[model samples]
Target: MRFLGNFLTNSSRRHAAAILSAAAFAGASSIGFAAPALAHDAVLSSQPEQNETIKQLPHEIILNFSGEPQQGFNTISVSRDGNVLFRGEPRAKGQELILDVPDNVRSEPGEYTVGYQITSSDGHATRGGYQFTVDNPDSSAAAEGSDDAKADTTATSTEGEQGESNSSVPSWLLPVGGIVVIAGALVLAIKRYRDIKKD
Candidate 1:
């Protein structure tokens, strides 16, 4: 009876130790996951200053983020009212996404909204917008030049739409699909073999 009691106590201690070790491991994993979440990319700065008015128009709208953007998923759009002013492929330099402004932008001076969507290197997407105004009072006199700018903006928007329509499956999807098909075929083959043996 004494030996039996000693064995039971030792077993309980071992079980408790395993549980404590598992809890510690889980705590460490939680911290590891949280570190990345806390370090997600965010807007660090923007050109033209949000809500600021400028006397001279900027050549481009620049956005700086806290981290590098995921390639092929970063986008920036500049619009005046509901009409797209500039839209095309976004260029990334370091942690910044740049949208090259068309020269005709100087012809129309009013409030413009710059919208940005960036997918971080970690596969998380972030989006935000800011507004800036051009304080050019003689914008009406620049209407002739504005027509060319408007046409350019329209072309850019059309190109953006076309690019979006060209859809190819993600690179990872092909391998995943092949693996699933192979697994299904194997399972079916095994079942058929088992039936034949049984028959």
Candidate 2:
């Protein structure tokens, strides 16, 4: 009778272990599914789109992204001839970052460049720049104005260049590690249960 009970208990343990192994496999699969979401978001379009010329400098520059950017984690700066006209304090509105040029800094025209650093929804930093020319007679002169635009595109909040934005490691590492730990614990528990059953 005791032998039958022991056999039944071991069978139950194997079944439990099989369930745990299946759970760990599912967990690993889920991690794989979520891996793609870790990619950095990209700029879909921007105000005064790339290489576009404008009659006047718009008070605000808007950037539309492929995904909703993180709030308070983005920036925009406008400059001409390396002279920064306005450093924008960008705000999030849906999938766009709106940077309002300060009143005092507006009105300059010339070849202006917009540089940005933004944190995507998945917590990746993206940085890039685009240029637009402002069509004003004084734009050429303004290009030489005081206070060169902050040319440092890679700010503390932003990543380096676009080429270096991709992550080298796989995103599933953490989740896989977690699953391994859980599986190990489950195995140890099963082994302990067998030891006690044998006794």
Candidate 3:
């Protein structure tokens, strides 16, 4: 009986050690899997920063990232009232991505959204967006009882005549989708670990 007890105790210790080793490996693997995504370049700052209000529309919109963004397949789009007014590839300069507003692109905006997608220096695609307001009092001149009201009306009409573009996908879609995929993978790994533990 004493010999049998010793063998069973040794087996339990071995089994517990195996589980501990597996848990440690799984923890390490999860961290490794998520490291790249977490290290992807982040926006350090923007010219027309999030929720900022400016007196005039900037000629160029600039986004500064934590690391230099890779060129190609990069996009920056500006929108107001659900209409995309400008959408184009930005000029990548060091850690800054700049989008020049077209000479003909005029805006009388209350709030505008700047959305972007860029190849991260870490080689992953990252996307995000921010909002800024253009509270140019001159924009509302057409509604005022002033001599220049008629001219303002004509300008507003011209702006309307220059039809707007629409963005089909949200800028945050990629990052959000990546997060979901990663979460699912981690859940699957954990489920497999639980099955092994059961055995």
Best by lDDT: 3
Clash count of each predicted structure: 0, 5, 0
For candidate 3, write residues 11-65 as lDDT tens digits: 9999999999999999999999899878988889999999998977889999999
After the best TM-score superposition of candidate 1, give how far the Cα of residue 13 lies from its true spot, in angstroms.
2.3
Q: Poorest 10 consecutive residues of model 1 by lDDT?
A: 102-111
| Candidate 2 colliding pairs | 83-148, 83-149, 84-148, 84-149, 109-139
What is the C-alpha lDDT profile of model 1 across 1-199, one tens digit per residue? 9999999999999999999999999999999998886776888788978999887667878888889988787778888766887776688898888888887654367788888877876777778889988777666657767998999999999999888776555889889999999999999999999999999
Give me the overall lDDT of model 2.
0.82
Q: Predictions ranked by lDDT, top down?
A: 3, 1, 2
Estimated TM-score for each candidate = 0.61, 0.51, 0.63
**lDDT for each candidate structure:** 0.83, 0.82, 0.89
- Deviation in angstroms for 41 in model 2? 1.3
Model 3, residue 194: C-alpha shift (Å) = 99
- Across 121-173, the per-residue lDDT of candidate 2 in tens digits comes to 88878888999887876665656552244334335336554336666557889
- Residue ranges of candidate 3 with Cα displaced over 4 Å: 139-199
What's the lDDT for candidate 1? 0.83
Candidate 2 TM-score, true structure as reference: 0.51
Angstrom error at residue 154, model 3: 14
For TM-score, candidate 1 versus 2, the one ahead is 1
Q: Which parts of model 1 have CA positions greater than 4 angstroms off?
A: 140-199
